[model samples]
Target: MSHLVRSGAWVAGALVAGVSLAACAADSAPRPIDESSPAPDASEVDYRDGEYAATGWYGSLPSHQDVALTIEDDIVTEVTITTPAEDPTSLQHQQAFADALPGEIVGQQIDVIALDRLAGASGCSEGFMNALAEIKTRARA
Candidate 1:
């Protein structure tokens, strides 16, 4: 009937408008930290020495990542990142990230390490940051 068609069109229009608003909001969201800039020193912050681990989720496909950090005298001594990526491409990307992470973070003070992206692993970086925040909380003396 004419009424049914009119209601359907109204519903479709509402759906389109909702999707458009969501897209705009996503576009205006804050961007990740820039890797090129120098990170501020965290040497002054006191940290309890121990191994800390945290899990984080990232990407549209929602990959889960775990990061473990070993701290000694408030400095990071070792770093381990694990990503259980079933897809071959995802595995490769995660492996590259893992390979590059140690050199980027090891021997640095925990507070100064700002890891957002490395070795083309942007999505995993978000999860890494989240895990790092947890580690920081545990590290507080």
Candidate 2:
């Protein structure tokens, strides 16, 4: 019993020390809005240059959104989004997300973009990201 207690103490101390080290190493600095590393050059693009569109559906009620984007030199030069949200609340959130997405994605690489809660709309972001995946697939094809 005494040996067991000693071993438990050792383990607890080890865990505390490990956690302290990790906390010390962690930076409070938030991650950049664009989480990706460097993008490929124009000539090195694996995807073709063109316009593509996709529909993203998300949430329990199955809300969806449509997105159209143009890529030049593997970078998103233009983007358009259409939200078919019927519920007034849903429409407001979706509209807010739609309004903010272009500023976030334009002039950025397609593959590098991953949407978050833009304009305080998480559900809309889910739909938007879902749509972006399809656009990436079509662009790569």
Q: Where does the lowest 10-residue lDDT sum fall in candidate 1?
A: 13-22
Q: Could you estimate the TM-score for every candidate?
A: 0.68, 0.67
After superposition, which runs of candidate 2 have C-alpha atoms over 4 Å from their true positions? 1-45
> Each prediction's Cα lDDT score?
0.67, 0.67
lDDT of 2: 0.67
Q: Candidate 1, residues 40-104: lDDT per residue as tens digits?
A: 55665789997776766667676756677778998888776665788888888777787888788
Error of 1 at 105 (Å): 0.4
Q: Number of clashes in every candidate structure? A: 0, 0
